[model samples]
Target: MQANSASGMAVHDDCKLKFLELKAKRNFRFIVFKIDEKIQQVAIEKLGDPNETYDDFTASLPADECRYAVYDFDFTTEENCQKSKIFFVAWSPDTARVRSKMLYASSKDRFKRELDGIQIELQATDPSEMSMDIIKARAI
Candidate 1:
């Protein structure tokens, strides 16, 4: 694990590898990450399948926890062209503990900086904030 000295948080190598596989090879529909404060490291928590729906991606996120996720979103343009975009999400639900929220917040940049090729970024404290309607609106 390589740590970001500024944040005193380490990002596991698998996080980057998984991100690359998703970004370059489209191996996953989305990827979820969590921070272990005791270990001061960011690690992969789950990987969504390429065929999974957007609802599946959102369902994987806990209702009362903080997480960082990357999603590969596919959509059709008004002109009927198929397109895909990568999204980086910072999930800090309102029901989560303050300590957990703060830790995830402070360490976000360090972890996000490791995943490249992200075209959009969304930070949400509630499910509605990252709803599919909002996602599609932004994607379009």
Candidate 2:
């Protein structure tokens, strides 16, 4: 029965339920909602956009497995709704225990550049196209 906090306002359970339903209807799912500040910092630093800051992100993991993940980053505020930048990652299968080698980069352009010559198990704007293929996915 914990209340959700947004902009210091106490949002009740009913509102939370409705929000979840709406997200589902939109084909959106959260992979890791609250990324650690350090991770965010490192990602931005490595991505070469040091000044950009994102409060949170929503990802489409699609299948129960974390084979391929696509994320959209944004800063949520009442004054602005800046969004639509995407980050994608390909995770190593659990049997390999190589999740630590997960590779992530932003935008399809960068995704192509960074992951070039590296075989991708899946690639599409639609998450429904992702699969469980894990071969040749040398994690960065």
Top of the candidates by TM-score: 1
Model 1 — TM-score against the truth?
0.97
lDDT of 2 by residue, 1-140 (tens): 22112211122233234223323332332222111223321111121122322222213232233233333233333556553333444533343323222322222233233222222333433333332222112121
The number of the candidate with the highest lDDT is 1
TM-score of each: 0.97, 0.22
lDDT of each: 0.92, 0.29
Off by over 4 Å in 1: none
Question: Model 2 off-target regions past 4 Å?
Answer: 1-26, 30-66, 76-81, 93-140
Error of 1 at 3 (Å): 1.0
Q: Residue-wise lDDT of candidate 1 within 1-140, one digit each (tens)?
A: 78787879999999999999999899999999989889999999999999999899999999999999999999999999999999999999999999999899898877878898889999999999999998998888
Give the per-residue Cα lDDT of candidate 1 at 104. 92
Q: Residue 112 deviation, candidate 1, in Å?
A: 1.2
